[model samples]
Target: MRPGGSRLECCATDLRPRPPPPPSSSPQDPAIPSGPSLPPAPALRDLAGRLRRLPPSCGPVRLIGVDGHAGSGKSTFAGRLARALGGAPVLHLDDIASHEELFGWTGRLLAQVVEPLGRGETAHYRPYDWRTRRFGPPRALPPAPVILVEGVGAGRRALRPWLAALLWLELPAEQAWARGRDRDGEEQRAFWDGWVPAERRHFRDDPSRPHADLLVRPGHSVHEGYDVLPGPAGTAGQGPDSHRT
Candidate 1:
């Protein structure tokens, strides 16, 4: 809630690796544990191709929100998909959230990002400055053809109506928490203690997977499989009301 309280102005990756090689196209086989999946270049391109074709679900943009427990590999998966989409823009919840607000930052998001995007305009948001423990200057996000919103609550009800699709990082809560804690290291252990239940309450009340168009479980490698989740609200899935082509 820095200075940009709400009024919206306008608008608006990388490649890493795999725990093992990407699974066969079917992706149903257990992930081979021998090594990580280093996806072949062609497979990466295919992801880009398919994502490019998803019907535009947001006003004029195909906005896909990736939601899951923190450290559930949501950031990594979103980065890969963004690259596949030829550098599609990814908005991380970390940028919008602060230690103070945590899950309470939704109103700022709607004011700064969703409202403008709904009108097919670019939007701006003040990313939280973690080190300073406060928000910094405003950053602008253009309304691209495909905008990937990645974070824990990217698929919350307040924002779902404006999204084209919701994807759940299907890893279990404990596992995700472990990964997140490991990633942050001992430095952030205290912060994580409080974060765990805050996340639980957030999901318990406004879960997003029930409305996910895809449930993504990252294998030992980077390749991902998407399961079609049934739509929970009018906001998602392959029902008669599904927005997917």
Candidate 2:
């Protein structure tokens, strides 16, 4: 087990015009092929607007937390949400985590990213080079209207108080791990062996789902986007205990 609360601080297009567009069909239409959902454009736009309007949880930034299992599509989902938020900045936890300290980079993150942002200043953090086992050059993260922190443990207890909203990708653990393993392939097989158990322990003690403001589920296809629903926390930006089990 690793230490917790280590200190510190905190779109696309298409083109091709071959045939006329199909008749408008309600999303509920069963006959509709689950292929072009595209992150529920209208919903995402509304969410973006809401997030922008929210009071900044950090100094001048609405720090949104996107938490989920290792391979539950947090990165992809955050990328789409960022575009919907008009190019909002996103901080991937992967850049902060390393082989030896997989879930123990909180101190580095707080000092490098959160503290500066909390002070209404630019934050610079060195991204970890997994291949080299060392941190890289610093990258700056300005205080934006909305900034997404995406990865596992993003909504952990220590960071929840600083989040404007916490979103959890709803997916079964076994399935998510399987996808992660497959994505990493044989080269990272040993890594996965160590990671799976660590992740399980992390979630077991500091679960994020019960405190999520929204629950996101990927659609049937890559193009199908995602389906966002009220999470166990009920209304977005509300109290964490509002719907905790």
Worst 10 residues of 2 by lDDT: 8-17
In model 1, what is the error at residue 76, expressed in angstroms? 0.8
Q: Whole-model Cα lDDT per candidate?
A: 0.64, 0.69
- Listed per model in order, the count of residue pairs whose N, CA or C atoms clash below 3 Å is 16, 2
Per-residue lDDT of 97 in model 1: 81
Instruction: Please provide, for model 2 over 1-245, each residue's C-alpha lDDT reduced to its tens digit, 9 standing for 90 to 100.
Output: 01221111101111111111122210000112223444336656667777786677878888899898877777766776787787888897878887778888888888999889999999999987666778899999989889999888999887887887788887788877787666556666777788889999999999999987677776554554555667776533333231210
Per-candidate RMSD, Å = 10.1, 10.7
Best by TM-score: 2
In candidate 2, residue 182 scores what lDDT? 66
Off by over 4 Å in 1: 1-44, 221-245
